[model samples]
Target: MSIWWSLHLRREAASVPLARRLLLGTMETAGVDPDVSYDLSVALSEACANAVEHGGDLHSGGASQAYRVTAYLDGEKCRIEVADSGPGFPAPGPGSAVRRGAVPGAAVPAVTAESGRGLCLIEQLADHVQVSNRPGHGVVVCFDKILKWREGALLRVS
Candidate 1:
């Protein structure tokens, strides 16, 4: 049977570490290799940070500014999902204003200066990254990584 784990936390930046810990623990329990575990942890942390910074206005909802993290192991792949509670932004398109070398008119220079590289890093680490708006609420980032199976762990057929 496939194993699934989930966590929900505030969208505050401080909660990023907590989210990473939860993801690491879940991956360890599922027998994920250490290298794969590290990659997943870093990618998830970056995604959470992005959601908190740009997904919506956290102060408007006060303590309600929270995000949800869910992870699961499906055979040789690990799946992770992070959902936030704010109006979502458009998915960054390749060579788009936000991603291109030029700064977009819509983005505030200060915020971009601090954390704009998150999506770029996520793209590098994760095998697949998907972004979508959570109907009526915020945005969801889903990512998947292929797990490397260890040799000799499985019995050979005669």
Candidate 2:
């Protein structure tokens, strides 16, 4: 069965875990591999947390002021996207092959900061990760995970 969901959440600290829990529940009910679900949940939490921390304009709930999380599940593969409404990341240099916004495990200049490891953790956990900024609107973080079940499981997707 195909399962999907989308959430529009206030850009607050409390919303981070809420988003994670929703994803976990969705994956569990859909019979996803536990380890894969866990990794995706962690990655989703980090992405949501990043949106809360840097998406900006939390006090206002006006249009284009909240963060969005969307998840899609089809058989053994799951894709999730967390988008925000803010000024967005800086433009990538023309000569650069991949935009900083769409990079995987890209070195963050704010490594010395208290909480700059989200993207790195996501890259380590998710099977695929892509980030892109919407020029003055916001940033979108898209990630995917492929589930693998242990042998002898009752259900396995080819």
- Would you list the C-alpha lDDT of every candidate in the order shown? 0.72, 0.80
How well is each residue in 1-158 modelled by candidate 1, as lDDT tens digits? Answer: 46787787877788899989987776666566779889999999988887778666756775347778898777788888988877666545555444432222223234438556766666688898877765457777888898864444331111
lDDT of candidate 2 over 42-97, digit per residue (tens): 99999998898879776766745579999988777789999998877655455543
The clash tally of candidate 2 reads 1
| TM-scores, each model vs. reference | 0.75, 0.82
Model 1 bad stretches (over 4 Å): 62-64, 90-112, 134-136, 150-158
Candidate 2, which segments miss by more than 4 Å at Cα?
Answer: 59-61, 91-101, 104-107, 150-158
Error of 2 at 35 (Å): 1.3
Lowest summed lDDT across 10 adjacent residues in model 2 is found at 96-105
Candidate 1 clash pair list: none
Give lDDT: candidate 2, residue 147. Answer: 76
* lDDT at 16, model 1: 90
